[model samples]
Target: MPLILPDQLIDQEVLNQENIFTMSQDQADHQDIRPIKILIVNLMPKKEETELQLLRMLSNSALQMNIDLVRMDSYQATHASQDRLKKFYKTYDQIKDQNFDAMIITGAPVERMDYQDIIYWKELKHIFDFAREHVFSTLFICWSAQAALYHYFGVPKQEVEEKIFGIYQYEKKKEDPILKGFDDSFYAPQSRYTYVKEEDLREIPQIQVLSSREDTGVGLATTLDHRFVFSFGHWEYDKETLHEEYLRDLDKGLATQIPKNYYRQDDPQGDIIMNWRSSGSLFFSNWLNYCVYQETPYQLEKIKGVKVAKFGGSSLASASQFSKVKKIIQAKEDREIIVVSAPGKRSKDDQKVTDLLEKYYEGKKRARDLEVMIESFRKDQAAKRQEAQEALAAVRTRFQEIVRDLDLEEALKEDLDETFQDLDKTQSKDFVLSRGEYLNAKILARALDYDFIDAKDIIRLKSQDQLDYGESYKAIIKTIHKGQRVVVPGFYGANAQGDIRTFKRGGSDYTGSIIASALQSKVYENWTDVSGIMTQDPNLSKDAKRIPSMNYQELTDLIDQGAQVYQRDAIDLVKEKNITLKILNTNAPEEGGTEIKDQEDK
Candidate 1:
């Protein structure tokens, strides 16, 4: 069974219990195209349970995924049936020669035992060594994460006083591509007897900590490049997984407590609250997208050695800037993907597209030159409605003029009217905010004779307005035709209800970074007003000089210090992918601008 499994044993149960569907019918139609080849090495003792859990977690994306189950060559498990292993699992030697887009190494039950004393330690080491060359990316979970960290980075794990078994709250240490759609705080299930110290990870320059909790130590960690991810939490666990573990321990007369923040009100007999399920889904999906799908070469052999460059656009505010961008693209054969922001102010007196939209939203809520404020929840008044209509009409006029100036034909009137009416019905501020990028992108696409793609159709956001990394990547790759010059609107995506939503301020750059990461562009060129990133604000100090280059860490420090070089979200999207980011000036395209590279690259 591959991407579109017709009747998996766990499909119905998972679908009913967790709502994890592999792909839509539309996505299944694209199966004539090659599917991502993924290999899962099941090291857990309860092979069948782990199989169902992992498969369910991997099933939500639109990517056509084919999975191969693997087992250690040196050891036989008495827990899993030998017949099942023979029928379904492939030994390491059988698949070691083949290449995989991604490989997942599951947690083993032997954490207290010494690494050298483990029965399959030698075989596991061999597989790990093979994965470096044979796999594009690898996800190491729980005990496996610990083992790999020890083997690769020489990081040691220390024994804890007691087994850490509960649903714990973890906060993101910093943003990473692997956390594309994660909230500020999330819940994850931890069941372990030993933990890797935060200090140990700090000593390793290559390893980056992702999620950590005060009570539980490090929850997730990854390498600088993110080709390898070490996850301490059981992100693929089902709702009752921890409960089942606790029950098993209690049955053996071993001391165990009820999982914390798990069962509703901490009563074991009460309903189990599934807080960690969404976080788990997001984690797996992100690893698949940013680490595997985006990094893996289309031609499997090409993965042995590969390089990438990415480029993007600025706030194409005026016809002058638009022409400059077009010239820049024509100058280079490699400029394939374009990220377009909303038009900015053409002059001092002119209003930015986003500002105009925000003004319209304000007008929609209140009548001009009146003491009374019009509320959306109340019945519409004629005078207030007239004010709102005039505001929308003004915005439409600007779009029409821009389209006309660009000498492009578009159904701006019809689409604007429809979208405006939809917004009135829904009263969604994001839908209003999105029109800035939407209109500009359409105009730019027509002007350049490129395909106009709505970010909503590709960039996916959850109900919580967080990005769905894997699904977003799949949507982009599947929807965007290969070798086509495509222009995507920045800042917005559709939520779970298919309603428009937007990112925070200066999100156009964030959108640009995401597009670059997904496309694996060679260099992400962020064209803006300034020459490049300056050492200090130009207005604050006339002596401020543009930095020629900086590493991701330096850039992060600068942003934290109130520098406005990029939106906070942009760096994380590109850093892990190793995509070079350049800050270039649209006015002076010929001048060499600031180049952001890896610390080693600089």
Candidate 2:
């Protein structure tokens, strides 16, 4: 119902004519907010339908946007009236100096001809280049997609012998920032006669295939430094527009199958299914909100390469002016498990972390579900910390009992849980696990007696401010190692490679082991609330026994019964990198914690 300035407008549209962050005229009855300035370069021959279709999509954004329709002068087929073009549209040269935060180039029906052959090809190219340099970001639809890709990235398009007209389904090549907030397997309306094959795009490394059909290839792109994005299919197509084409073609006796894989019944006269419309709108809105708005220069003229020297500095937003959506997450070209997050949750008010992380992976998804897992972890950590604290308190009580009794073997022997049958189950287990040296050593560290140093020097640090590092990122990750008391956020890490990395939810055990392997810790003590790996569930086994020590092989076997295991990742690292791991109760730091040594260490 409202405009949600997708990426493009989200950043650069802030202080310009295209700001979608306001209310529309229909809602004008209530408020006085400035509306977003939106310009559409309607290249379609049927101007009326294209106008209605595009306007419908733009009007639905969460942000407020006003539509300004800009059409090219008659360059090809004849359809729109001369008076309409003259009255409603202005050439790129006419609006060259006027700053727009966002713009769209619709697909025209001219695909059979060469790029240079279209009468307005040169003019259309001007608009294409101008949008990149001037508008924060531009969306080129169908014919425009081919023209712009060829013009901008040198990816050539060829006219296919058969018209690739149909309701084609596309598998996402990989999620891109522009497609943020989209559901998996989104569809776009395609009714074109030409194709831009992936093979043709290989030479230009800047162009990336976002989603492609197996038959037609390359559906969308956000390449050339992401200053330009192109959608080969019409995500903004009016549902009836395609139906109109199908019916029109059938009447003309032009051979056509009922827009393949479309309408539920595949009947030409069946009820039109608009399943793809929802995702299509979501994709476009995200692009405008995130890609364009966040990245466009604050000034407008610099895009045309004109220094603001004439205006005393204020033509376009500075190159640094656009708000950053997210840092680039580069995949390491080496041996290591790569973790990917789900499309991120947006910042509470005016934030786009999903956009940020998409930008992080260079717009290619590595591991899906990372974002949801991180959010879930943050929610659970508080409860975990409280459980740990209660355990620690009981451990101290046990330490005092041990000191007064002076019988380590007797206290350690005789069913440990039976010794504290009077306490609550949780408290009883905490009391039993709390032995002499282990409990007191940790309590010593807690009280700041400083018997040991936390190994933070080996792990990366966090800034309550920006968790991801800037240039200072290098200095922070360069400072981690063993015996150095340091605190690291459990779910995250900063690679020396500049991208901040993270682990699975509750993957602290895994992270600690990896770090230990990297440092080759002589004794990688992984402290937890448990005494050691317990054999049976306490609820299931009234007399469940705790196993003290086991080699990696034996421990991993027992751990495989669906319980969260540590040694899986630890040993993975140990075997690959040759390091050892130890499991200890942080509350009970000594108690000869499970020494999971390899065969050689034993």
Candidate 3:
């Protein structure tokens, strides 16, 4: 989507050459769709360049975004002209009354100094505090991430031994929705003198580490709910950004280390690898799609107290099923958290998305050349790779068509394209296996007008293969809140090792139960094909009727006796919490299916 820039101020010819859409005020006034309002508090010295860079990043998404540029009233900017600032920018005071869909606080070149020592620190603190109430989501980049961490959490930043200048590979600490479609590891450029330690972040329970490198420490951290995304590295940097900085430092005779893993053979004159661009694009697009566009309330004022309803993919497999789910959600104002699985089997011979993924995985065989056993032979593996690519392409195309048919945000279609590309770079069996649910969750979120949170991020498991209920529940509680409808994908959770793990068959039910129990929800509605559990095996006895009510004991016995309704583990998770498990049919939700409860409840 296009960024709403001032037609007179922005060079239309330049934007056109770059393919960036800019609308005049007169043009914007007539549009029926309300553009997402984004506020950028540009702190970088080169304000215009930063403006262009940030706009380019925001432009990749399929949201009609309106940009409001702001400059600090208390501080003077030396790099940008006063006339330019006065013409295009507004001070925080001027726009304080208005609420924004999202805001971006860029990095200032003052990280080495104490927070209080900066001239505009006081005003910046006010803006930071203002964001909690006025902005639906805020992104703190580089120094701002550190500043927010210190101001809100009392975390202190320490100067590093040397400038951490380089393109470094960071391990994704958790599977955040922000990092959805991201590989197991990705590279980001970092150039900083001061840093926030991951240990300090751990002290504050609300702060969750999203990504970190072995030596570089925490690269990204955010509040458990992801209302705020803090990026320590420069994911917005262009390919030659580091190289330009390196050259400038060398020209000035400043002490610096060569940016590690950046140049070919560590040679400054050699070709620079643009490794972070793909991940960067995906990161920004996800923030715009999941966090800003979907999470923020349309009326703006309703954002504070929205409820959550999580819908599984099986319940939303078709248009009719989606309509049923929508009706069910409309009946309750407080149900907004949605947990979606990938599309399920429509017929006996039809394939579930998850099943197709397993087949796709099979096509990616590691072929080796006997002559050179050290590495896989590209030529030998070409045919298999092509086969895998074709299978994966079908899955991607299927989801793309669904999203298009549903009239979702254009950014979502772009996301599908990027996700398939990211999937091609991964060799992890589990990562490839989980794309089914991830894509499904995105589609459902768009269809239901709810934000999608990846299960791999919030659902925690121990390194020993046991559920880490304490950490998992804490994270979920921090993330999901009242007045917000969110859909989390099911079937898998990540362990301490960052490996995706799944439950037995019908794990999506298990995932839903965990979310409900954790939140102490009023009821856990498990939507399925059948109305509810039948009196007997329906397949065996045609006379079997839908059971209107049952206790947990009876449900467990039926499941144990091969009645394929609810998983035993799923029942056990929510049974103790007294959360009534309502099984409603997606196709016939109006029929009002069975409600399973404790024996005393009857």
Name the best candidate (by lDDT): 3
Worst 10 residues of 3 by lDDT: 365-374
Q: Write the per-residue lDDT of candidate 2 for residues 1-602, one digit (tens) a residue.
A: 45432223223343233322333345653656544456688878787667656766676566566556676654633797776666666766678667676788888877888877888876776676566446766778888888887765466787776677767777776767777777667777888888788767654444667787657778887764455677888877766767888889889998766787677688766788887788877887787678755665555443332100000001001111111100100111111111111111222342122222223232112122233466656445444444444443443344344333433434334333443332223222211222221222222223222232222222343541223222222322234421223323233444344333444333345444544443323344454445666777654777866777777778767768666546355456554433445554433434665666666423
Candidate 1 achieves a global lDDT of 0.77
| Model 1 C-alpha lDDT per residue in residues 207-316, reported as the tens digit of each score | 78987765677899987667689999898887888988999999999788778888888999999988888888888888888998887888765444211222233347
lDDT of 3 by residue, 1-602 (tens): 66788555568776787677777666777989999999999999988777777887888888898889888999988888999898999998898878899999999889999999999998897787667667888999999999988766568887987888999898877888899999999989898888888888775556689887657778988876567889999888988888999998889998888999999999998999889988988999999888888889897654442323345556666555666776787777667777667777766676777777776787774432223444455565777667777778777766766776677748586878777887777766677777877888777677777877888778998853477877888778877765567878787889887777776556788788888777655577777777788887766888989989999998888888887787778787778655678887777768778988876544
TM-scores for the candidates: 0.49, 0.46, 0.53
What TM-score does structure 1 among the candidates reach? Answer: 0.49
Instruction: Put the candidates in lDDT order, highest first.
Output: 3, 1, 2
> For model 1, which pairs clash?
308-522, 309-521, 309-522, 309-523, 310-521, 310-522, 310-523, 310-524, 311-523, 311-525
TM-score order of candidates, top first: 3, 1, 2
lDDT of 2 at 157: 84
- RMSD, one per candidate, in order: 16.0, 24.2, 19.6
